[model samples]
Target: INTGAIKSEAASSMEMTELQNTESGEIISGNLHILANSTIDNKGLVNVNQLFIDAETLNNQPDARIYADNATLNTSTLNNNAILAARNNVSISTETLFNNKNAEIVSQGNLQIAGVSIGGALTSAHQVINSGGRIEASGDIAINTDELQNLNAGITTQWVTDSIERIIEVQPEGWAHKYDVSRFPLIHNHNVEGQPFTDENGNIIRYFEDYTYYDYTAKTQSTHIISSAPAKIIAAGNIELKGNVLNSDSQIVAGQKLNISGGSLQNSATPGQKRVSYNGTRQFRDWDGNDEELDFGGIAPYSPAPKNTEFNLGVSLFEDSHADIKSLANIQTMTLPVVNSAMFSLVAKPTKFYIETDPQFLDYRDWLSSDYMLQKLAFDPANTMKRLGDGY
Candidate 1:
């Protein structure tokens, strides 16, 4: 258990790695491997060339930082509060993971997280998985969980737009003074019917005449470029939620396809309420304005029931993934307000599919017309060919 500050010179490299710090610790190593039961408390820094931490539970506190060329953290529980960055790949496997308070786990290469519950802000040059934390990747993003709650975060893999330019010279009239005259051998040899140029004496000259033009105009050769790679976000689970706000922070934007296989997707401000109906004769509706009444038509009615008898059913009003109700009925639906631009897919098998959008629904047309979204969103097709800055 290291409590005091451990310092190493820039040239130094420690080989061993087993950290159980109570408060603070720092390791500067070439290659390190942290065994089980290791914890990095506040202000801890693990900077190494390669790091592999196979611990029971690895908790990186708010001020902690871990930097490496490549890292692999295999733990039962991983609670990171600060940053875990790597130049190459960063693979983290855990049963339970919590990346709280805007914590970041970034990788310049690929990143993979296999866990039961995942919550964090993850950014990678390749692949990643995240919850109500911002997930940005250049490649694919695959997340398989039991339940996902992205209250106020986004998953985006925007297009990669870049441009190049070259300078072109424009001449008004005559050829330049430095023009090569060797090609016109007839003018120099005086063997053709008409000489290239006449001398001052109005006689054909053996030598070619110089144009003597030095001034030339220069113009920019601009090429507008628009390209995008295949970026997909596949979120498969029982339930998923990507906030109800209309801001950019809650959007799920993919360059290519956004495939979501979930039992329910609640995207509205108001939760989808469920209604209870006793028998086929009597009907009880959801108290909320938009109630999805459940039909118990096939099932038998309550036996020996009083006038106001209420049988306790093991189901919550907002729990859409009720095992009993889900098996009996079809509740696989998506409540998405804004769907625009890219290709979108929702997989709720063996049920009549439907999408419930907000009253004030917005699509690509609205997104392109909005001043705020125009300035904020990436790769607007309307301005794809328009020259705005130094490069398009």
Candidate 2:
């Protein structure tokens, strides 16, 4: 279809196959299921209630969009790089999802993207929960997961391994002189152990060397995440996160080994109370700031006023009225639905919890520095037992 909309209504299921291209308009329905060897390149919009795709190959371009409240996809390959992107809610599963490194998954509710490989980023109003695979949120991220190794949801953040490593780099002789090594002439070289330098008279010289080292220590970002509602992601196997795991709150029970590396683990939450607006009798304030109920008030205002009186339309029965004409009391009110909000929670456990830094990554930072350089490794969460090269 070049333009306009297409609605398919069949009893069992509807299928759109052998289609290579599609343009404008939107296809909105209750549920959706896409098959392989088909292309749905809608320029306008493509909205569905529950969306599923089992295509061998799927391509989502700069202008394409596939929106749904819940999505479950199993594609061998996918390309989603839309400028506006798709607004997908609920949990999403993929076999091998490839998103634009720049494009992000936009959602207002809980999101779980578990796949063999994921390339894009995720932006949510609720949380990025873990069901399987590995995930990491860069900064200001909210974490909510399903299960833990040998444990259930709502377990405290546990550290399995914490240690430090030294990164050694060998440079040419003139390299030290060019950068001026006066500030840090020598350091305790972890690699070159017990090798001593000698003077012309065979007298022993200083044993320390000139290479730089990094301490891979464990540091907590935030304590724990707190939220009103709870969420969980249960998986059958181990859940490992090679990147950062940032969350606002949760409780967890670990079942297997949970591993992370080359990333940070964070849990944060901002808690506050909301003041309720009361609809009652108005009070008159005196010049001194003291206030009292007006004398005209018969009794205190009883029921709450409708935020909107008309929309609150409903039938009501009246009780016995006052027999005498002088009696008063005749006012109707209704309480409509209000107080809707979004909440998030997270929990994860593994047989072990690990967040270790990669010493090889030290070259990315201050490699040009000289004379007792500080090799600072990027904050990376660990997922396994780590040992210094020589220690093991």
Candidate 3:
């Protein structure tokens, strides 16, 4: 039948067209074959067992969806900005399949299509597309479109029809969702439906890559960037870092040179690894108010050393990654704080010494004895002493 809208009706024997939204309607079951062009402008879900569409053109809306077990379309053009699913296989032999503008697909079997501008994505056990097809995708993509390899993948949609005609080419043995600009080619596909990632086994996820030259003027003051994975910047040209660039695994690789004429590439500043512990350095207020009689009357310990003397100094300092920084500009020679920011916690105590008073020269008891020369009377009647500088 050739019509715009189609609703199935009961039939005696029809297996492929048992379609129904809710069970409230009549048990209509029939098969239909479209011979001319058709457009499904629906917003609800459509489920069918098998469908054979030989229409000249198929135009689907934004929220429309057509699901079937196996679908074949020999149309001239298939502009699908909606969803199309098939449980078995989907073969489109159209001249051009503009699966752009939010078009999505799911194939439980295999999918083969020939097109020029392929902006949408398909999930199948196996997907094969003809050459000269530009595809933007993530997750595992087994593609053989090497004819359009010379196209430069710009970082936007402008790369789609750039006269050279850029196509989102997936690397061999690489998932479309795992493109690392530093290690692999830049993922210049934008607005692809397989992005905003998901963990579904049959989904094509999206990844990110940094641009070569990012600019910042007075108008662009504060900016915050958040990513699901580590951020990387790989440039064949120059880069100017102006503000604070923070990342868990932030890396910047330049092929030839980089021009950082202004702003610094300094990391977060933290205090050095240093600590001090006072040993036997506590001071008391002479609680009993008797300094000379404390040794005899009280049981407290006393030292003959003066108050200005140092008792002990326990300093614990060690070298860190910052100390190993040989040069600030020569990033290759020295270690980077980004790689070695984690410090090891350890304590190295200082050596403490105990002075002995048992020797004759150091004995305070001998010096304080009454027989010593210091204990002799200063002015005596029978004292015999020479004047100063005359005799000792």
Candidate 4:
């Protein structure tokens, strides 16, 4: 029961039934193979410089546990339901550390804790890698880099949701500021309809006010047509859209060459009004007529855009075709002619398209005239009604 000196030279080949009351300080330098049921309990410590377990003799009945300051287990095969729990440091390396289809090793420290599991727990702090294995742990799973030469090694981890909650913090300071009104002082006190007027603190002050004007006789004239001559229109931050912009066939396309280098370009469709319909039972269906159905019932069903009803058209010039856009639906066709020394032209025919230009070209006015020309041709009464009636 109380062995002062315990040594197993060929312990890797032998089997251990039960190892108890080794509190006298037992030292195991060789492999400690547990072929049958074994338990090292009563707070007894089995100090092993190195340990090994045979893979062939592992079974459900034989479960091994070691309480030691530091222990190393190297094995090619492990039986099922083998629990190797260490109080301090535990190191294990095997072709596969598996037992009863589930093997677990746990190591807990003050600064960090590590574990590994093929079917169960195999814990270590220095290094842990699971190639084609699964690991379920409550603590962190990190690589052992002290002895490793390469820094970019692959590591897989499956941590509990509770652990992620503890590690990741959601601070108020991390919240992004949506709009900053101080930059645009003209927009501060302006009572523009539907334009968001915010104070210096980025808080919205006045929203869209729906008030119709009876005698709102404004200038109703077409945009100035400047032949084929180029013009320029620039903005500091962004170009936003509030209402639907449609062509003759109700299709929307890019008006001009838009460039925004610093700020983000976004497009958001206004949701339609919801209409409720009652089924036979108490269940009621709220249909906004905005849900888009995709036909993929043969293999699998996947609809990326479910609440999109309207289509969009985007037209970019040869110079501004590569701008970043938010969304693009079905593109029809594009025509491209070689310019300068650039190889192959880029063309896209999109049903619904959104383009984001660079901000650096905002103040640059070379593309503005082209934009105005396109807009004038797009909205002219003579051309507008014909284009709309033609069913683009």
Candidate 5:
């Protein structure tokens, strides 16, 4: 427009005689086109919130340019032949440019601009030349279908089958062997140092090359000593000893049963310093009656009598049979009247004698008679004469 000022309030179209620089400004509805070269000066803002430009009839020239600031361009159709051109510096912000169809450009010079927004897809069949400026969009930027297929065909091919066969050839053939202790000596015989030798199928094979003699004597002795050792005495049993029971510092008597009838047993003491004395009577009365018979079944009475003598006596019973009193006759003739009264009057005498006053006599009779000696003597006293040493 060759006017200094032109403004339109509503839908109106105007035709200009010659497009020229306006000092004030120019505004038009529907569309605005400048057929000649024009400059938009500083402090001159051109805002088109919804505007469309048609370059189909312009022959796509390189000399054409459109300068707008804080303006928007909304195009409805974007065909392959449609074009957009911007002159010098075009700073667009707070604006949007949408294209419904494709766009193309044929330019040689650089498009020097800043902050331009595109709101739709941009497709280009030919090359896009951006020498210095930046073009940004929120949507996809793609090439045309024919150009896309040509780009994909330029990629090189790979031989996947050959790569897979090479991988298979280099892979290991067997599984790993694990270490264990239960298969020790046998396992060590087959090993090459410490690692196990494996077959092709990953199974361990006995190679028998690394055999070294193992001193089993020391190992077996150590195990036997450990298993045979006794536990420490946390609490003493009923049995107590008057002196140190251990023979020496190196050995221990583990299997013996100690009987503490009257004294305390000392684990570490001098010969008689740590003596254990009788705390109570060795021969306890079965009941209050002193005439109570001693049961010789479990223990022999600690009384001065024959080995097989059973007495109707109590806690006043005699000491155990000593070597001096060797027989029943020796016991009967002793100075102790209690011994003769208890032995001769109360208990019957043994008809057969194995040995005189021998502790082995009871054991011998028990073994020979097979547990019937006590029963036979108690029930039938006359049976003693027939059996003799061999009880019936």
Candidate 6:
């Protein structure tokens, strides 16, 4: 179908095997029902009161649109590079769904997506870009998938805010146009006869049917996404995000409780390299009974010597790697064996309170006693022991 329009009444629904619209072709139906074995491609306007689609593959080109009051899709694969806007809800159930950069899936009420994966293809290593997928709704958004491996996507349930005041274009008479004033209320001043401005001879001089509306200029292009509605993302298996070193590059926020539960989530694609280095000064008493400052030589010298002419050191140590001593400085520190043994017993005994939720996971006691876990806790920068003692 090309360069024309197909109109239907509200009582009947149209069914098709394959729909290819181009050259500004238009389809206006009460309800559109499409069932294609391979693909249902659209490159023009598709306006329906309601839409239902079941196909193996579907694609909406960059210049195309599929607008409806409500839309429901069941397909194996979908590559939506254009717009899929619904007034009420947009529900999709597929094996794989990839919404490309600049693509949109907008709903005024609810948006739900259930699939194996979203955005990029599943892989072991994280992908390249930080952002690509776009999914937004004014109500709630729910996604249930095994892997949500997007390239730093931001899934939001926020209302869109226009950044600039756009010129309103009014279509001519005899054109089949859907009135958008129902969605956006208009503010205008009219005369006593319930009309707009009038001429000197008492003749009504009206502008376009729906007068021009004004949109205030905004400071930023981004939407006011800070106060959003409730959203849920349940990755039943695992989730992988790429190029998310910065927090703002990728986020999933809810207005109330943002519930996100998955088996695991990761951002780094490569294994981290382990390295540790230290530089400072140490004070000690030499064999000749003379107090001397031994320079370890990284940042500055140690001050206020400890007992027996030894200095107490507070160092930020990194485990899994040996400490690199830059200078040949003799290092010594007093150790309390009794305190160390007592602390370990208390920290390890409390592990029995945690039940083993999965057989694959080690028992709480065994995991807490592991060499890696112990070393990590001891050198944690956030002071894990302090938080634990506070019952956090």
lDDT string, candidate 2, 1-392, tens digits: 53666555431234566333355655655676766466544354555656666665566555555565555655444555542212334344444444343223444333445443336643211223322112212111122222111111232322222223222222222234112223222332222234444433456654322222212222212222231222222222333444455433222211333454545655443322222222333221112112221123233342233221111111111111222322223322234223211111111332222222122212123423211121244323243233122110
User: Which candidate has the top score in lDDT?
Assistant: 6
Pairs of colliding residues, candidate 5? 78-101, 78-102, 239-260, 240-260, 241-265, 262-278, 302-318, 302-319, 303-318, 303-319
Cα displacement (Å) at residue 109, model 6: 0.6
Residues 162-249, model 4: lDDT tens digits: 1111111111122333233243322234334445545445678543221111111111121111111111111122222211211111
**Deviation in Å, model 6, residue 30 alpha carbon:** 2.3
Could you estimate the TM-score for every candidate? 0.37, 0.30, 0.28, 0.21, 0.18, 0.41
Q: lDDT per model, in order?
A: 0.42, 0.34, 0.32, 0.29, 0.23, 0.46
**Alpha carbon lDDT at 114, candidate 2:** 46
lDDT of 5 at 86: 26
lDDT of 3 by residue, 1-392 (tens): 11234457432332232222221222212333544434423344444455656554566555555666666655555666556665566666565455433345445455545333245542221112111112211111122221111111111111111122112222212333422223322223234333344322555445322212111111111111221121222333333322223212223333334333222333221111222211121112111212121112223232223212111111111112233333232121212232110011122222211112212112122333322332265633224232111010
Q: Is candidate 1 or candidate 6 better by lDDT?
A: 6
RMSD of each: 33.5, 33.3, 41.6, 32.8, 55.7, 36.0
In angstroms, give how far residue 206 of model 6 lies from its true place. Answer: 89
lDDT preference between candidates 2 and 6, better one: 6
Determine the C-alpha RMSD for candidate 2 after optimal superposition of all C-alphas. Answer: 33.3
RMSD of 4: 32.8
Question: What is candidate 1's CA lDDT for residue 24?
Answer: 56
lDDT of 6 at 36: 74
Q: Write the per-residue lDDT of candidate 5 for residues 1-392, one digit (tens) a residue.
A: 23344444444333333333333443433334332222222121122322333221122112122232112222221221122322112221211122111222211122111112346433222221221111222111111211101001011112121111100011121323323323443322323344455545667854322222111110100000111111111111111222112211111111223232222222321111111111111221122123233322342222122122222111111111121233222111112222211001222355543222222112223345522765755756355443333331
For 1-392, candidate 1 gives per-residue lDDT tens digits of 66665544443432334456544566666677667554434356677667777766678776567777778877766776666766566777666666554555655555566553236643211112233333333443444444444433332222222222222221112333233334344423435444344444566554432222122222222121121111112222222222221211233444344444533454422112222222222222121112222223333333223122222221112222222454325322223333221122232332211222211111112222333443576655354443221110
Evaluate residue 53 in candidate 4 and report its C-alpha lDDT on the 0 to 100 scale.
37
Candidates ranked, most accurate by TM-score first: 6, 1, 2, 3, 4, 5
Q: How accurate is candidate 2 locally (lDDT)?
A: 0.34
lDDT of 4 at 317: 18
Candidate 3, poorest ten consecutive residues by summed lDDT: 153-162
Q: How far in Å is the alpha carbon of 328 misplaced in model 2?
A: 66
